[model samples]
Target: MAYKFALCLTLPHNTTKMKKKTIILLILAAIVGLAQFIRPDNIKKYENGVKTEDLAGVPKEVNEILRNSCFNCHSSSSELAWYDKITPVSFLVASHIQEGTEVLNFKDWMSMSIAKQKAVLYYSINKIRSGEMPLSSYILAHPAAKINKNQMQVLEAYLLSISARGKTDSVKLKALERDHKWVKPALNGIAYMPDYRNWKAISTTDRFDNGTMRIIFANEVAVAAIKAKNINPWPDGSVLAKAAWTQEIALDGSVSTGQFVQVEYMIKDSKKYAKTEGWGWARWKGDDLRPYGKTINFTTECISCHRPVRENDNVFTIPLNLK
Candidate 1:
């Protein structure tokens, strides 16, 4: 009986230790819960910066380099990876993206003044050349974002080439901006005319890292063709608009889009647009509805991009998952 009583006395010491462990566990659980509740409100302010696939005027070879190394924070196409979903990590990502866009968002290339664009390009070249970009911390997490020597050369060359062209024709490009063709009212034509947001979302795509997200919306006629699975020549009168946004990151580690970036329209007219392969191409940029292809040279430039898909009715909406 005495020995049993002695053993019972030791039980209190174990219970005390158990109580401490339980308290520590409860504190940890509480801390985690509190962390979750204190998350950011995460308002989706506007279309994201601009997506990789949406970068206009960037050549394919250099585009690949940009997509591979610079797109994440620099472009609106930043989609966080699996590791970025953690709470504090996601917070850091969101903060970097917000700051990155403010510094210089490549997605705003077409929207910014040509002079400003040239200046930004030079700044970017300096940063990349000095190993200052793709942030060291960012590179630690995403080694792929590390710009290589060859890619650096290609990017700098492309930027210099564009800068030279801009310097030579800065006046012309600016003047052309006022002379938009396929004339519309002095209002935001493509954005407001039909209100693309109300249209059916035909498909969305990843642009690697040129820094944009592209979501295609189909007008009623085009939606019908998509639903019927009858987009052979994509009957005349069908309209499809692709909206580009700067891809941002939310506190939840999901893609949070920012303000309006760009939108492109493809109107089917087998007869009228036959020369361009049966599609009328037009692009409206920023909130002002700045026309992209203001001149014949620019208009034909659109053809080269779509020329590859000529067999697909001069449309890039083929692989889109329609709903």
Candidate 2:
């Protein structure tokens, strides 16, 4: 009689547990079902067409690789899978597409200038090489988007083939020696900072697209921020200067900095330049130190190009740790 009573007590507890689980499962099912009815507002049915012709001069193989891997997210002619249409997941896919297109859209390939196209291609390759492109989450869902070593080599080779290679012109080298004591300010009101040459070198980069090499320098305030590892917001008064020069390739494939091409600066002052994302943007192109842009609105181009790295405080260079 005692054993029977114990079994009866346990039965009710088990039954109650099962009932709670069933209720929870039902609630989840209802939520999922309701989500299906609500689609993302930005999600649109992408046209199932491949516009390979838009990339006219791109090699056939490269075009195929881009179509298979990048076009879906980077172009207007995206081809979506059945699973990508599911709610919540579809919303994420739409966001990725929106962000990807904003950074680099192949649909506008023909519209870009030759130099701009090369720069875009170079930037795209860099992203791919860094394992940042075809985002890990994206590759998990779309296995075909994963680029292999061979595909990467093909892209690199194509870029190198198009890159300008040769000796630098002596005339341009001589032109860089001119005095810059009275350089004019950019149309946006940021004056030329000649003393940036004395700043500490923070990082260096090679621009394969434009066939130039660049050195990034940080002013005293910027350097202090780097040392403290407090560069995300990069405290007010921080200044960074990037000086670019033509790349001179020797017969043995060694590359050296040649004639000075340009120097760009980013000054930080959150309240002072609140309208321009808390940074003063200015660029002086060529040895003559002529300010870039015809009007004050030139900052639009700077903001657009740096938009992809907005998370990095709109700065691209990752400063090396200082002692």
TM per candidate comes to 0.43, 0.48
Residue pairs with clashing backbones, model 2:
none
Residue-pair clashes per candidate? 21, 0
Tens digits of per-residue lDDT, candidate 1, 80-196, equal 676664556667877777788788777766665555555776788788888888799999999888888888888878876665655556665555444333234222233224366
Q: Which stretches of candidate 2 lie over 4 Å from their true place?
A: 1-7, 47-54, 164-323
TM-score of 1: 0.43
Superposed by TM-score, candidate 2 places the C-alpha of residue 155 at a distance from the truth, in angstroms, of 0.6
lDDT score, candidate 2? 0.86
- Across 1-323, the per-residue lDDT of candidate 2 in tens digits comes to 99999999999999999999999999998998899898876666453445435486689888888888999889886788889988888889888988888888898876554555678889999999999998999999999999999999999999887774644533432333334443678999998898888899999999999999999999999999999999999999999999999999999999999999999999999999999989999999875578999999999999999999999999999998876
Scanning candidate 1 in windows of ten residues, the lowest lDDT window is: 41-50
TM-score of 2: 0.48
